[model samples]
Target: MGNEETPESRERTDRTGWRGLLVDVTPLRTSPSFAKLWTGTSVAQIGAQITIVAVGLHVYDLTGSTLAVAFVALWALGPMILAGFVGGALADMFDRRTVALVTATVAWLSIGTMTLIAFLNVTQTWPYYVLAAINAASATILGATRGAILPRLLPTQLLPAAAALSGITMGLAITVGPAVAGVLVATVGFPWTYLLDAVLFAGAFLGILSLPPMTPEGGSASPGFSSVVESMRFLRNAPNVRATFIFDLIAMIFGTPRVVFPAAGALILGGGPVTVGVLTASFAAGALLSSLVSGPLGRVRRQGRAVTLAIAVFGLFTALFGVVLLVTGMMVGSAGPEGVNVPAVVLAGIALAGTGAADNVSAVFRTTILQAAAPDDVRGRMQGLFYVVVAGGPRIGDLLAGAVATAIALWAPALIGGLIIVALMLVLLRIARGFQHYDAFMPTP
Candidate 1:
């Protein structure tokens, strides 16, 4: 072989060349405080997912209408949007840890109340909607506060890895949580499921309690209506941040296909409630797998490009989901009001899994960009906007998907929505070359 390296040697050298991929999770693993927070949040998230599944089932069992279950999000959307902006301001003005703690406590109480009402056989629709709205509003505040606190817990270089880990946690919660909820509702009943969620929510306290006091990063902004408006003005001047939010909104609004899931499960797929759980879990499954195998994600220099590409892939997969639905529909002829008999459910689940994986990759990059780029003083406000996009966009998608499915065929909404996402993303990417070439080594706002 003389002085030439053998193929095996070259392969080994190449494999080790991208060492940045091996994200040192030591900070998270070693920091007792962060570890407690992670553990508590993980448990709580699973609980929250369980409640989500339970609430949907409860509503559907009571009304037998997908629209009613969908309306739960609709009812919560206004409050959630308002809270996201206001909560962001709160995170900036107050101690983030305390804010998170209080909100989490309130949220837990809301669930506790829900469980109580459910056990009493209070089948009123208004109570469910009202309690769910309260729970959602509190969760929004907690989400914003927790997001702002993340940068403080770890080094800037590790933010992407942290984001990836968060995705994994979310994936785990949704993947296992809903399935567990289905079984619990089937066996132990909704009251017990809600009670379990209430109990599990106490775990969030553990996470919040472990954190040292984290004061606002910059001088506290006055907390009021103007503060929210001023934050909006600040974002208008910040083109890069604005672009990030805009792109995220577009991706979420057009690409999210979750609303049509129930109909898909019942009609296009033969497996009813079990199918619904599988379809939802499949999305999380893709996300979980992506995060687990994301060793190469940390090595990426152009995070913005990675984000754009990931979102684009997300749209493509969403389109594939629609196509699968369309094909199955064609194969099984319309069953009118009765429902179709086809094998599209499994195929749709697979497509959703792909979409979830792609979205997780985008989430990792987008969150890192926001945390790394925004000034600490304004990080809270920016994170608030991030929350709005993250929380609000999906609600909008739910409305859009629900309305479109009702007006047209169930599959038509996903088919058209997915195409819109792809087209819009391509145009946005072309216009924002700076975003495409954004290097993580030298951060920019």
Candidate 2:
């Protein structure tokens, strides 16, 4: 205890024995404010998921096309990317708490508007696109700001633990939200479901309001085009950070299989909206279980290796999902009442849950890298860039999955994407020994 112990070193020592795997994070979970933020975010996220399912269901009902449902995400991607970068930069220039509060208010208002439109029987596709895009864009901004704010609230060593906790929140939101949404949409109708989200969004506002004013780590930079360019230059010089972003982009771009969900729900799995909910929730369920048992993650020192390995595992699980789907297709033969089977759906859900768990582990490490390594003054801009990569990459994956599924089969995209991810990660790991050996105890410049 008297020795010169850094956070990373202490964490490593805490994991030295078999019992190290059971290292308690309770001692590190001291920040009441962070706990409050976590709680608020968790609640709001559940509501958000409910709205997402409702919106997709509403769009598909109106248009009767999988592409139309996919377009809702595609329309939002560009604006969301731009807003994330701008929001991140603004977070560096102003009070993060205030920024979050204002943006969250806008988000809630957008949802309220959507609810009104739905209630009025305006079931047109355009309104859904417009409102969904606005909501997505606002969410992008909120995500970046929130990412930047976390490092300020917790100790560096606790970052992994915090990430695990955040994963739990995400897991809970996704698991509960979509499942509940499926029930509500099937029973209560769409307007009430969207309205409920608007109400629950107030929880997010409360969380942001409770946070202390946190200015940029360094003095505020002027908000302008030049500032953004300067941040880009900073990122160019930071090879480790660049590598982390690229790796995450590759994983998301290749690994995300969300677009195939509706097709799987209606045809392959045959449970309709309920199957979609279950499939989606399966991923969150896996993530939630992983985070609940993630005491071992807090002690890992080679974070870069951990991230790479976790992402690779995610790809493997994703591939497994594709294989499971293929097997289900083989068993069912076609989309019909007799083809509707429970065991096949359950197997696919299990595979998806595994993928979600692995992805959450990767997210924790990637987030830790961004929070710990990036300079405070430039954190917002970097976060914004990170947001763009994270958000943008998945959309690209959606497009790819949709195209491939339409062309060949729904199962082909996952099989090909997973293989590509494994190959890409292996190549990246070999080339960048620096990333693999990155020590959390010794932060890179």
Candidate 3:
């Protein structure tokens, strides 16, 4: 315990709270492979964001229906789930490096195909749907592979820090990526933005190539029904891991308010799409700031307790955002095209930022728990489930928010959903003894 404060730890923290907030950079310095992996994903994610937004813009440009643009996610959802399970099984069976490399190559090729479609100036909706689905499937695989890859790169004690670092990576990608994408699509057009994604995707290959061979210690299981059953059985006994997934789902499904942003921008806030972008990015911006100052998180002994509180805070902020919208809507009617409630917009953004910060804190602990507690052989499958929960939860959220918004007011759904999240999370934590008492220092799944 006396020798635990290494030079790297000293770099981020002191007795003072301000000094203790910086993210630890030890993972980057100690593990070059992890560093490469982190850097590669960070660079490529910016380009990925560009292509994602560009494709949506291209679709809306071709057909002026916002509903058609929503098809992008719907088409991809099926393939994304299939790939997650297959990818996890394959990762446990083969060398992790090889699995990542192959999946990354597929993802790269999908982007390359998009570039070709852009160059051809194809306006067909079917082709766009197909390519977007392919890209999503490949990305799902890549995420599971990377989740399994991280624990091997760093020691258990540093898993929390590594998760924080990854949070920072995600925060940056989500914060800056789409904003840049919006500008690029408006100025340079769509093809170049897609090409940038194709070029940047090669960075993932560099990271995969740098890793030492990582063969699973536990015996391999081939991808099929049997593998799925086996993994499911393992999870059935892994109460803590299951609790993590449930907690995340409750947070995302009830707290996510992304679907209402457009309504808020148009009807309530009045600033139009620009306002929508600002509000959307505000959440990620807070996440970025929180991750940068997450050095103190590693010291927390009861990570489950931390996650519980953070998620509750997230719910509270989400409710606050809804209140901002509700009050703004009352103060003024719909302001037609390009209208804005300046003060309300600012306050709404602050609430969203707070939600983002709390959510990121929960994410760091949840991710650390999965990586540290799960065994090497089963880690891939656990990670795959994690990806599914994480990726799928928001889509469910979108539908919930959208449907509820339709029935009631734009702000009412989020307000109701947030309250539901707070109540549900508290109930789950109180009932689930394993989750509430989960210790970071001696992790179990």
- Model 1 alpha-carbon miss at residue 222, Å: 2.0
lDDT of 3: 0.85
Q: Rate the local accuracy (lDDT) of all candidates.
A: 0.81, 0.82, 0.85
Deviating ranges (above 4 Å) for candidate 3 = 1-17, 333-338
| Candidates in descending lDDT order | 3, 2, 1
Please, what are the lDDT tens digits per residue for candidate 1 over residues 50-101?
Answer: 9988998999988999889978877988888888888888888889988999
347-426: candidate 3 lDDT, tens digit per residue: 98899999989999999999999988888888888888887887799998988998999999999777998888888778
TM-score for each of the candidates: 0.88, 0.88, 0.95
**Which 10 consecutive residues of model 1 have the lowest summed lDDT?**
1-10
Stretches of candidate 2 exceeding 4 Å from the true structure? 1-28, 60-68, 120-125, 262-274, 327-337, 341-343, 406-408
Best candidate, TM-score: 3
List, residue by residue over 21-138, the lDDT tens digit for candidate 2.
5433542345667778888898899999999989999999888998899788889888888897788888888988888988898899899999999999896799889889999989
Model 3 residue 392 CA deviation in Å: 1.8
Positional deviation of 354 in candidate 3, in angstroms? 0.8
| Residue pairs with backbone overlap in model 1 | none
Model 1 TM-score, all chains together: 0.88
lDDT of 2: 0.82
- Model 2 vs. true fold: TM: 0.88
